[model samples]
Target: MGNKILVVDDEENIVKLVSYNLEQEGYEIITANEGKEALAKIEQENPDLMILDLMLPKVDGFDICRKVRKDGNTNNLPIIILSAKEEEIDKILGLELGADDYVTKPFSPRELIARVKAVLRRVDYTADEEKQEVLKTGAVELDLKKHQVRINDKEINLTPKEFELLSILIKHPGQVFSRDNLLGEIWDYNYHGDTRTVDVHVRRLRKKISEYSEQKHIITVRGVGYKFKED
Candidate 1:
């Protein structure tokens, strides 16, 4: 199936432009004119990915991002934020709020499409791996080949990043890695960006994993960094 995307924006022109370009790329496009409506549509449509505008009536982008990140079924879904807010803090806050990516406004439609394609590509690569076989960790069986994560045979919904992060941790089992280390190893980006990127994703991972186990699956070392639970 062609990728499905939900574009949430208050501007009609922005909506029409993104919708047109994405549609031309064969992505099924869905849109919302305001934040509250966007949230409602997200609940009903459950698109593969979302493009959210930071400025909107009622709920606003940060609130919506938090709402989706908090939801059990939707927590793992990829969300990309679009905003004209130029402040570095705005961008940082968006990422910290669990946006998979961010695009500044007055932007290139070509770049938007490129980012969308890249995120979809990453999600697809992992999903494909999870379909063929199951991976196991002690009593936890995470079948990357089957896309099923079972702890004592109880299934769970893990986002692509969560699953990938967990797999790396479990496979390593005792590695003490810093955020920078993780960004280098897990995230495909080789160049510049804040290491907080790793920190934010780690927070999400911790939150999602808490749903599956009472014992912490991730651990933090004071004055150092984080590591998978090794005891």
Candidate 2:
């Protein structure tokens, strides 16, 4: 009917609940009860987005997200982690592993749908913005057309979330974007209550790109937010 979403959860109730709600929203749903099956379905169905659970059998959701992000074929697929863990570290790990959004278990169906819509909207927005071929700042260069990043002439792997976060900062050097603002612009969801998601992605982006560039351009402004240092 609409976007195809892969729901991967070991619990039959969770899968049925999510699939039922998403189906009602006009989304085509594919269900998987284990991590390995989810990966296979991802390859076979090429779903537009994935709703993953952390405590999955055989492969686990974290490993699945990591593998998906590492693969060139499905690296850009949008992911939303649906887990029971509410720990900050768990959320951070999920985001760092390339999940676009994280929803705790006992989640509201309406809110999950909202997050799905936000992520897909951002995906469409970025695709349209890719018309601006190249973006460069200091030693870092981003080719939106190619969906690639090069630092000091050496290409480095970046998850889609990381690339989008860096691209936003590099495009507007020295501008401090508040966590709320950044969450809105980058995630396409105004997660004012949980700004830590932005911080996690920034941390991952800094660590990965720091190997090539001498300067870590992701500057955190204590209570304000973050910005890219002007080259």
**Could you say which candidate leads in lDDT?**
2
lDDT of 1 by residue, 62-157 (tens): 999888877987876888788998688897788767787778888888888877887787677777764566656655677776566776568776
Candidate-wise lDDT, in order:
0.78, 0.88
What C-alpha lDDT, on a 0 to 100 scale, does residue 116 get in candidate 1?
84
TM-score of 1: 0.75
- How much does each candidate deviate from the true structure in C-alpha RMSD? 3.6, 1.5
Best by TM-score: 2
State the displacement of the C-alpha of residue 17, model 2, in Å, after optimal TM-score superposition: 1.3
lDDT of 2: 0.88
Model 2 lDDT per residue over 113-147, tens place: 99899988877766777586898877889888777
Report clash pairs, candidate 2: none
